[model samples]
Target: MTSLTIPSPGGRLASTVVAMAVRQRAVIGDEVTYVVLDRQWQVVEPVEAYLEYLRQEQYSLNTVRLYAQGLASWWSMLEDGGLDWSRVKVDDLARFKRRLRDRGIDSTVITLRPEQTAASSTVDVGLSSVLGFYRYHAIVTGVPAARQFYEHVMGGTMEARSRYASFLGHLGGGQDRRVIGRRREPKGPPPFLTPQQMKVIKDDAGRLERGTGWCGDLRLRLFWTLLEETGLRLAEALLLRHRDWQPGTGTTAFVEVQPLEDGRRRLRAKNQQHRRVYISDELDDLYGEYLFLLVELGVDVQDDLPVFVNLYRGEFGRPLRPETIYDWIEGFKRRHPLLPSRWTPHWFRHTHATALLLAGVPEHVVQRRLGHRDIHTLMTTYAHVTEDAAMRAAADWKALVARWGATA
Candidate 1:
């Protein structure tokens, strides 16, 4: 690791000004893992330990990489402040939060408010990672300074539930602790594609070839269809295998989203949790058509092979990548002006949930279909849908009351 030092503001001290970086290395037999390097270019032991613990606890590789990046930012902050990692205080963390918020401002420009460089939610993610690092060290190594970052509060108290339990504690009873200076984020609905927009995008993805029944790019078409219909995450859909597709009796079918470890890439399903997402019979027929197209192209299909693979581009038969999907969306948006300005693959998930709620589906049923471990997440995320539903019912209440009066 190469290290560089720059003199501090008043030339009073030389501080490491270089930011830390994350690297991937093969540990055992094609299995890959991530490690963080400090500004001085040495492995950060605490971060390495925490990442390993996450891996052992079955956290996805993408999640591990994300946490590593956050911790890397923390290490850079510590170096910039010339502060020791082990001796950081609550005030230091607050400063760190400010630094993150002001990350992209131009030094030459002078303006109040700093133009809001980073979103509050993004800063919160970084802070959460840093706090989790300290929390791990405090519990495992009994580091006194690390323990100072949190305040233990009794369970069943409002503050405890709202603060401590939300962050680091188990639900429903016991003493818990929350990190100081963790910002409260606003609750809002996630963005989703409208039905007409989804239809246009899917139709544009793959068109039927003239004089032939095959679509131009069946693989890409199938991908958008799967996400739109089933609400699968980008990674979850990418990690799907041929065997995971279960064709039920007489036109019914479902796809099982499993936590498969792909040795080639660090791709895994989010949360490493298993759940089945049912698909429409039309989608089932689409899958079969895609298979037929695969055979025509001389690409062999197998049960263990990834469902979405690169048939038209790099490394035929290799798993489709999340980067490729993002690139596709970028080009797609350029071609189509009707899509939402801030549309994303995640919008399919939001759209799916919103549609279900609006169609009068029970919250719990939607929760199960979406593979949420509990209904709380479902309720919190789609609360806007429920609230809108209530308002509509209130608007129709006069007619409802009149009907009841006449019946009586």
Candidate 2:
């Protein structure tokens, strides 16, 4: 038998074993034995083979982890019911699905601590993961796959997608969808900083430059400036490299994002599209300053190297993670009570969009600059800013009307 042990939360070892008999059956068209925690189960070999296929497909680490976790949970539940995976029928899967749905409903009703709420939504995602496992297993084994199971369990219906979206909306202080098909509650405008508050934030970031012996201060300043100027998402900014910047004349600097982690450097943007952003003279100067600071620190200015690194970490040179930037911004907010309470990285994007709109920039230009795949996303998110612009147009219309009446 080949056995592997994984450490559990309470310092206990969970054992997983594959027997020689199972290996022989796996090679043929028969059942295999898998033992976990001293319990034995006869499952079809395809389940194991399907998992290997998923790994080869290059799914995200979290996705792979969740699917494996789901399978383990399903197996444990089946064992509790005195059933093995090979003997489990469609009726059993249906009953398991019901239990999952009930558990999810209960979780939704329970109030979780602020920190725990994010983890709770995994219940729904876990359900989908388990269903996907079964469907893949059946496909690989040539078993009679459950069509209804795939439809309801794996494919989230429109209603289910809307409900999931609402659940997410609640985390952001929006309304939860009611079960009785009532109209969704109206939501207020998203929180954003005013122009004056934004100015204060910029000033606070500028103060970092005055400190002595801060090796990465210049990079930090550039980070903040790029966030404000380009309005890129924090994740997008973190993935940037020196090669992304183009120094030459008429050509614009571009940012390419990828949905898959492996493709981040090679593929196009998140929407599978590419965008070109004009680098202002100020941004060019900041980039130069960053390069100079890198030279001062005795670091090579390689095109493949990350644009920013943790200055505090000694010469090993670890690239800064996206969450670290958020933590720094939160720390800055705590230090400066005068700054707006609602300030966030997204607020900088909001402020940029608003400032451009107020300055009479066209909607299409703003859309391109923000790298929005859909113009509707730009319109919906910044609708209030557009409304304010609409009011200004109305005021101009009133003036024209009064002037024409007077001339008549």
Candidate 3:
């Protein structure tokens, strides 16, 4: 039996190799072999320490797989330097951070495209995951100095965390060092159709009615109408079921959204709150036509059946994905070729809110309709739309003063 001594927080300690076996078991005939060690100067084989961490933490299988791969890569980097656990130091960890930057691993963007380098956020997250593995090993093995090394090397403190984050920012051409507190720039306003332009779009969508049967045309018509009238999120509109509709007079009606896979009825809403929207008269008519069309298609007008179905048959026929609405909007853009590139489905929600605010609806009411939890959200996001109203009020006040002076 060969004995290996590693430095621990307590002091230098000796471990003996007990047995050798491969870390992973082969699915088919045989498993890989690797040596395992015991605490005494005797060799003993034990299960991989990282797997124990996953089991103890109750990590999901996917998470375990990711962590295992990341740890393996980190261990390989350490081995390339001929450094074992006891030999690892803060400077070594710093070098690893640089290597990650060199490899272009980014955490911010889910998928990287050509010419897209890893963003600072992305690198930090990946490094953090790798750091977690070392931290876990230190705790489990009862290595005395291991914990201190990890803290100085990878602890989530302002200084330790900043070293890696700053390196990432430098890589990305920025000066930001703090990782968690940084705020992303606010997205520009949602592009919306003006009242006149919406009339044009609706009319264009209506034109599709002539070629397609009434049943097919109803889907596009109602989809557009709901977007224009309700300010519902695209997913919310697509997830609507028959039971969600209420046809009573002067009463509020709404569609309930359930979680769906893909963009089609996917549960990825802004805040995960179930929104109940009042159907506008125009939307009600569209919904009526949709119901009639559903009956004609021999599709039961029951709650279980998807309210919206794919016009073309394929896997997509499950229900309309949010992208489908955007695709249609894109098609509309192509047909017109005159609309601005910024125009999108979200623009309809913004347009709806802006129009209501311009018509003297209360800011709070607009907030509720838009599912904004705070009134400030409406005021801040749509401040530009209210500027004209403010200007008109100022002009009206001046006119009233002039009239009073003349009368006196």
Best by lDDT: 1
Q: Which stretches of candidate 1 lie over 4 Å from their true place?
A: 1-29, 104-116, 152-179, 249-251, 389-408
Clashing pairs in 1: none
Q: What tens digits encode model 3's per-residue C-alpha lDDT throughout 1-408?
A: 223446778886745442221123122232222222223322221224655555354443334444444444455455456667655777766665655555524334554453544455445545655555545545566555555665565333323332222222232333323232223345665455665676677777664445664533567777777777777776566666677776647654455544332321332355445656666455666678778766676665567656777755445436666666677778778889887776777777877776666665678777877788788878888887777665343223333223212111
lDDT by candidate, in order shown: 0.70, 0.54, 0.55
| Per-residue lDDT of model 1, residues 304-392, tens digit only | 88888887778887778777888888988889866776788889888777776766667877787777889999998888887785544
Query: What ranking of all candidate models by TM-score puts the best one first?
Result: 1, 2, 3
Q: Please rank every candidate by lDDT, starting with the best.
A: 1, 3, 2
- Give each model a TM-score: 0.80, 0.59, 0.54
Clashing pairs in 2: none
Candidate 3 yields a Cα-based lDDT of 0.55
The per-residue C-alpha lDDT of model 1 at residue 264 equals 54
Best by TM-score: 1
Candidate with the larger lDDT of 2 and 3: 3
lDDT of 2: 0.54
Model 1 compared with the native: what TM-score?
Answer: 0.80
